[model samples]
Target: MAFLEIDSLHKTFGANTALHHFDMKIERGEFITFLGPSGCGKTTVLRMIAGFEAPTRGTIRLDGRDVTHLRTRQRKVGMVFQAYALFPNMTVAENIGFGLKVAHRPQSEIKQRVDEMLQLIKLPHLGERYPWQLSGGQQQRVALARALAGKPQVLLLDEPLSALDAKIRISLRQDIRALQRELGITSIFVTHDQEEALSISDRIVVMNEGRVEQIGTPLEIYNYPRTRFVASFVGTLNILSGHVIDPSTGRMAVDGQELRTAQTLPVGDAGKKRMLALRPEAIVLEAPAAGRNTLTATVEEVSFLGAIVRIRTRVKDEVISLDIFNDPNRRLPERGQPVALGFSHENLLVLEEGVQG
Candidate 1:
């Protein structure tokens, strides 16, 4: 059996359904991330696992034991919140040892465990300081340490780094991933940030309107999104309306321009209008090599985003965004100039037209 399993999970508040028929199984010691926009039910799933909210209908199993009805404290799950829920009056050591104290562990054991956690978080000398004396990043580290001190079966991080600055958030996320791996603890992280999820998770569960849209590794999720929402939400994609011309040959027409794709149309989807998804980074400014798809477009806008150059071009009436790595030798085309945009057929994905949720 999987270490963590959620089966047919459903949550409803009166007439509104927050989650529907959600199912997932996680391996032991794996880092999984629930990623989605606000009100998408990502946090609800985390809360259900942590026993903070009832599932309405579903079962949560941890290590073959049913934990759906267990109390939060009895579930032996550690949770770190975005707000850094540390006690202001308690010193770092006190906060880290709070769970052990509640469980009535021996005082000497608690001290040793706290010291080990402090060293693990790289703040061994800060034990004497209170929460107020620490920076945002430091407080978050303490919160993480406190969560892990109990050695819970699973660690839940609910946007824990959302309150920190960008640089600090980046730094702390790396630290958290390293520590989680070293401890070999099963962890679930909830975040709306795409890059964070892509960077750290062993697998990503993309959620929408309380439904699991797609669950896969970062590369699979980014390169071959199964749903239109996943393609649009996970990264910068050019979703263009097109019609399937020949399903057998993967032929399609985009804005009246015929092109061949690497994906076949779904059964009964031929002759119907569909949406094609392509990553901005997949587009090339120069003419493609032989056997590649090429389109002529007029450059509408150019934006330099540090290490990347974003070019907005108009093909027929649709605007397509293309991202190219910034190179010192490459010259950017001016607005209103015509340029050839080239991409391989394999880079294009034929996505479902309508929203899933």
Candidate 2:
């Protein structure tokens, strides 16, 4: 049985539909992230799960029990929002203990749990400090602690790390993931940041315009994107358009060149259109190697990005991008130089012809 399930959950505000039959199943103690761009209804879905918003249609089941109509305070779900939402007038200890106190827990028990929560966030020493006294990252950690103090069944984090600096965001994400693992709590994280979702989530739900585009492990979403939107939204990819030359064999012709693919062309519209999705890391700039997809491309741009060198090449009318490890001894290729690019059949994904967004 699923720990939490959202079945055909529909939400509408006036004439605008926020979620269109959105659905997902979350396992017990699993970390699933709702990933999408702004105004894509990811946060709206999180709010529904947390009981802050009611769905227009469909049922929300928690551990086989329906909780669709439960109030926010009665759903037993903890939430940490983007702004930290810490009360500037309250100290960290008071904030963390607020939930327990509101529930009328004994003073000694609240004190003990607050102390443990502080220690869990690695800031036991900052309990007496106000929100203003703490750094942005530290303040967010306190917010997390306050949320966890309630010991809810599910933890919903809505872009909690987006407000922090890059360095602090990186560090706190790892810390949050570690704390979740230690506690074995089911978590639903919502974010638009691709890197953040890829690094932290066990599974990612790529949302677009109130619909679920794809849901899978990070590797599956990145390497074998089911649709054009998933391929472009989840990571950097080179989309090449073509037509299926052999409808029976799933061979596609790209810019007059044939490329082998793993996906069979869908029936009835076989020769109409086709496309291939290839990742930047999958394509390599090297001499013609045996038994690999080789394309002779003219180098157009070379960018140095610290650890790896990004090279843009022109193959016919389309510009293909590939990344190579930075080698100090190797001479950087000049612009307009002709280079052979190679990729394996496994790396080149044949997909339906569609514009990546």
Which candidate gets the maximum TM-score versus the true structure?
A: 1
Q: Write the per-residue lDDT of candidate 1 for residues 249-279, one digit (tens) a residue.
A: 8888888887789886666778988888889
- Where model 1 places Cα greater than 4 Å from the true spot, the runs are 354-357
Q: What is the C-alpha local distance difference test score of candidate 2?
A: 0.89
- Candidate 1: deviation at residue 117, Å? 0.4
- What RMSD, rounded to one decimal, does every model reach? 1.4, 1.9
* Candidate 1 vs. true structure, TM-score: 0.97
Assess each prediction's global lDDT (C-alpha) against the native: 0.92, 0.89
Over 18-73, each residue of candidate 2 has an lDDT whose tens digit, in order, gives 88998788999999999999999999999999998999998999988899999888
Worst 10 residues of 2 by lDDT: 348-357
> After superposing candidate 2, which stretches have Cα over 4 Å from the reference?
287-290, 352-357
lDDT, candidate 1, at 107: 100
